[model samples]
Target: MSSTRQFSFEFFPTKTDAGHEKLMQTAAHLATYNPNYFSCTYGAGGSTRDRTIDTVKHLNDVIKVSTAPHLSCVGDTKADLRQLLTMYKNSGINRLVALRGDLPSGMGMASGELRYANELVEFVRKETDDHFTIAVAAYPEMHPQARNFEEDLRNFATKVKAGANIAITQYFFNADCYFYFVERVRKLGIEIPIVPGIMPITNYTRLARFSDACGAEMPRWVRKQLEAYGDDTKSIKAFGEQVISEMCERLLQGGAPGLHFYTLNQAEPSLAIWENLKLPR
Candidate 1:
């Protein structure tokens, strides 16, 4: 609902006990920037439900930061999702990023009644009386499963009508993709805030594989810079900072609502980009 650009962050819950400390440290460090809200990603197929709840609740309770927990309906029953919603309400988290998460490896099929994110959005609406402001994933490049770009827009519209308050895209390297998608969706009259998802490319190989999996293209210029940095962490991070900072500038200038950084459990790139933006408090 804010006309000015705002910032939010995304993190995934860790698998080990030590990961808890690392995540807490990262959250505390980044909290000072006063992000609009921070999200903790739920693993595909409900893999980290407990951990996601724990991390999100901790941020709200201990860190006193607004938090959103990613919720996937890929393999959860209606009862299961109801319980999860109850947990979120009890933890004082009022925001959720509803997703029809990717299927588990080798499954090749959804294991739950809600096959799409809109269905999950409907479920959330039915469970709560607008207490939760739901966010859903949008694909600028077109979701791989969508029949076409138009279908993708229609799907996004359906989610908004089903009560999703925000839409955060999957990460992409092309700003044009985001701009064009926004134009098209605006024409559809949905009009909810569509925040761009930005992922700073720190590790070339790891980022490349993720982009491939998500249907986001990694441009040749980015690939060349990554290779040039080779094994040097400092150089790689500097390159990442420059790349993400510029991306954020372009998106804001082009009329994006805000930027969402997929921090990958680290604060350096996200923090650097925030400083570069110089957003007023």
Candidate 2:
């Protein structure tokens, strides 16, 4: 568990004054751990485009953290995306997470030239020349749209071939899913680091909603904890730390190259998990 491994964090853009303060504080607190990189997420349906850019700039320039801003293919034209690439380039931010984001409710499905992450990755490559290192998302438990698990893995291969340097998977509770996915991808010749994303769950019902949407499976032990401790914050926090700590230990034992925490803009829980891992500063 104490082995030297890469770590990164993901944060979302803030739209309100209070949220901005929270985002900054989260960035500052997490910065103390010296993560390998920090990423800012793009909102669904273009809701937080400006804030995404602003956050990336602030973190890179003011916070002095190496930042990767997520660029989504939702509700954006190629020209608009290119302009964002230029902005990131100018800011000395050379990394990106290309994603086909969630469509707006009632839109059925998103409409654009960049319909898939592979398309977005290809667009970035054609727009820049070795200037940007790109990462793409992976789904261990088959994406909702994929025809099957094989199709999902093939799609992942397409992203790697398209120009992805790293693949950060959607969060899941089972470590076996991640290990098996990585093994299968390696067998197929995809060599990039496939980092396991860990979610620190403090509430059962809320997590159920997210799990349903994202295809994450919650173990029965976790479910029991949530059922037993429902809204009690102290109990929830303690349970979250235990679950995540055990998961990280298993992931490390299974040879995961790194761990990426979905901090959800909070500090104490993620910080506590890191402390439990005794990770290097």
Candidate 3:
């Protein structure tokens, strides 16, 4: 994954050796398509700390793809963040996904030095200057915690102002939501690329659970159609591919900068959509 690609993939750090092998195999397969980079997710409050560092390094070093490790400030100290930033910098990692992250369960409320994403973005910029390209999250359908759309937009604008280099949106079924969100963000005078986060539709039940938790709307028609497929994995996947692929085509045609896929550490679903789009390899 390299050379200025308009698409990229995301994976989570595996906790087991076999899982690691599968992820590596997936990365190797996706690498042939030339993603901009392979991004590995970080767990809340640094829960998956070491695995994330090790996984990111392996993907970059073994798979030879540029990797971006997600860094969140939900339950970390300034010193904790500073040390990790220094470690990554020393390792030749040049990009990061800066997030406020979810509050790890059993934590009453956020107790981190940096409570919000803008603060984290500012901290990263202050600590490392322009050394790393920082990507912040964008909620097309509004963050579940956001009071209203206006407040969410303002928060996003603040994060951008705090030195975020780019934004990757939460996955949505509606292209109109992405377009409208981008339009609103642009009205605030922020011009960084807002890449739409794509979740390949593999399992409907899991997708439903994830969407419910993340505030991503699964359109009623889409839900009903998926419901009709009931336990038929093949039909579910085929339908998912069609719907997601068509929406992706509309998004690209409507002027999205690029697509960032939440690959779930698998290659087939994403590759199915990629082939559907006939996207440059």
Cα deviation of 15, candidate 3, in Å:
1.4
Tens digits of lDDT, candidate 1, 186-243: 8989799899999986787788887887889878998888888788978888887788
**Model 2: which ten-residue window has the lowest total lDDT?**
1-10
Please give, for residues 1-281, the per-residue lDDT of candidate 3 as tens digits. 22343698999999999999999999999999978888999997889999999999998888988899999999899999999999999998998999999888898678789899899999999999999999999999999999999999999999999999889999999999999999999999999999999998889999999899989999999999999999999999999999999999999889888899999999999999999999887
TM-score for each prediction? 0.95, 0.96, 0.98
For each of the candidates, give the backbone clash count: 0, 0, 0
lDDT of 3: 0.92
List, residue by residue over 130-243, the lDDT tens digit for candidate 2: 798898998888787788999899999998999899888899888888889998999889999888888887777888888988888788888887788867978887888888
Candidate 2 wrongly placed segments (more than 4 Å): 1-4
- CA RMSD, predictions in order: 1.6, 1.7, 1.3
Model 3 RMSD in angstroms: 1.3
Better of 1 and 3 by lDDT: 3
lDDT of each: 0.88, 0.86, 0.92
Clashing pairs in 1: none
